[model samples]
Target: MKKTESISFQDFMNESYKKVKRRSRPYRTFSFVPFSPFAMLDPTILTIGGIVLGVVLIERFLERLGVLDIVDKISSVMRFLFPLTFFGAIIYFLVTF
Candidate 1:
């Protein structure tokens, strides 16, 4: 049988550290969006909804100020209709209550 060489503690630690560094994977980042009404809902869906709402509001504001021109009439109409429908639903709910 061949005699095995023993590794010094410092050398063993360095080798282990190097192996760990080589095997390390990149960390993943996640965005958190806080929605009070939907606390029980999935965080990913909440984040996506918040992002979409922010984009829609920004685009509508820019369009209103003539800073952004939307080429699609259907998109423009849908944007306008969404807010109106939302407010109308709120009013209807309030009136029913």
Candidate 2:
């Protein structure tokens, strides 16, 4: 009769997994200002626009998961609303200031 040895899950994984090698190059940091034509936009308008964008994104995700429908109509509205709201915010800020 022959005896067999069983390997534990942790031991099997350790043996099968390969460690990634670290890069030898030194890290460098760079800084630059992002182009923001809306930098002067009103805070309130920006906040509202952000909220709308967030809702649209969440709804789209739900639609993908089959948890919700009506995204087609919502997306159509959002297509027009998104740029309008944000750009309106910037315009309003510029005009008011």
Best by TM-score: 2
* Root-mean-square deviation (CA) per prediction: 15.7, 19.8
Prediction 2 TM-score vs. true? 0.46
Model 1: per-residue Cα lDDT at residue 11: 82
Per-model tally of clashing residue pairs: 0, 0
Runs in model 2 lying further than 4 Å from the true structure = 1-42
Local error of candidate 2 at residue 79 (angstroms) = 1.5
lDDT of 2 by residue, 45-76 (tens): 66887799797888879798886557777777
lDDT of 1: 0.61
10 residues in a row with least lDDT, candidate 2: 33-42
Candidate 1 stretches with Cα past 4 Å from truth are 1-40, 70-97
The candidate 1 region of ten consecutive residues with least summed lDDT is: 33-42
